[model samples]
Target chain A: MKKVQDSSIAGERSVTGEFEILNQYGIHARPAALFVKTASKFSCEILVEKEDTIVSGKSIMGLLTLEGSKGSTLKITARGTDAEEALEALRTLMENKFYED
Target chain B: MNLKKALTKDTISLDIKSSSKEEVIEEMIDILVSAGKIKDRKSALNVVIEREKKMSTGMQNGIAIPHGKTDTVETLVAALGVKSEGIDFDSIDGKPSTIFIMTISPANRTGPHIQFLAEISRLLNDPATRQKVLTAQSKEEVVDTLQL
Candidate 1:
């Protein structure tokens, strides 16, 4: 639940949050697909970063390339009108471990 | 992290004949089994089938990755099959999936499975690479396109 709100532009709002991957298998294909599915539900743009690698939150392949193993932390950024809502939903998904062990 | 070890020329099929998601997965698993990557075909197929029943592996951009874990495979084993005509895979993007990559790994380990998926996913994420893979003439071409 660690998050920071940044409003650098006049009307653009962006939220950056860090969430640890709690699932036993980390961000494998299933969890990555779930994350993308949740991220795609919003109009805001989503990006996930682990270490120096940043990938589109809505891309399963991109998310897999992140190699977000168990115990790894991912920095998620949501930008645009529904940025906050997108971040909240994504945070919830991570908190639930994508509904997996 | 060695994708080539899991995928070989024998495991890559350029023209898959299956038209449905279930059939295509079976075809891919057969390829893995024929390549000696899987010992028990029934168990491997069952695991993937059950996993698919829970959630489809049909990804975006005409790609479907059906995978599962089983002790029948000592390590991570994978196969690539391409259907140029495309087939309904119930993808998130609502498009037909022409490229399929199925993987089977040991149930006890997660690192190799994730690593293999990460490497293959990253390779296929490129539009150019996908184009090359879908249009590859032979299994060798597919391997070259994937750089495996």
Candidate 2:
């Protein structure tokens, strides 16, 4: 993963991405669990935005509540002390198909 | 959140055949009812089905965790099952799921639900755990592997 320094602020940094859930079955319990597990590893506060709702990335229930389906579009944002690192971690996870194993 | 009290061995089913989402959920409701976990099968199925209508419970990989929160449930409960033949779940990863983890909780109990999700997720994320779960020969093996 490439690390990009924030240009907008002296110290503040953020990473954002729009991920499309490509799995045939949308985000279910297991995947939600995986997503949350990955998100919890970072110090940054992760947020998943779907439609009009925004939820804590660390909460499985919060992610489940979004009811993200196959082909659904989600905007994932992470911001905190390690916002850039957090975002990169999540981006890699998402790009790897949420590490479906 | 006291999963032992909520989870009964009777609530778990082994080698069930379900070609559709409703069939799978109906099987889950049957388990809940037979185990005295829920009084109204129709209502409980409705709650779960309603949630499914909003979005499929199929996750990445070959697993699906269908869940719902309803007044019909007296406490947090879980039902684990396996479909060796795999089912056509609308999974995000486009995979047929061989395992199903169905959960239900009272309408007001959010903490247990969150905790359950986290624990289950953690377990599934482990490659060793996943291999154990996938290779288990019987329901007892699956249950023992989960050890929740």
Best by TM-score: 1
lDDT per residue (tens digit) for residues A1-101 in model 2: 23333543556566677888776556656567678767877888789889988887886656766767667787887877787777777767666666553
Residue B111 in model 2: lDDT: 62
For model 2 chain A, the run of ten residues with the poorest summed lDDT? A1-10
Best by lDDT: 1
Instruction: Summarize candidate 1's per-residue lDDT along B1-148 as a digit string, tens digits.
Output: 4698988889889879999888899899989878888889999999999999888899989988899999988888888889988999999888899999888988999899888888998899999999999888788888778777
Cα misplacement distance, residue B78 of candidate 1 (Å): 0.7
Which regions of candidate 2 deviate over 4 angstroms? Answer: A1-101
lDDT comparing candidate 1 with the true structure: 0.89
Task: Give the lDDT of residue B141 in candidate 2.
Answer: 74
DockQ of each: 0.89, 0.09
Ten-residue region with minimum lDDT total, candidate 2 chain B? B1-10
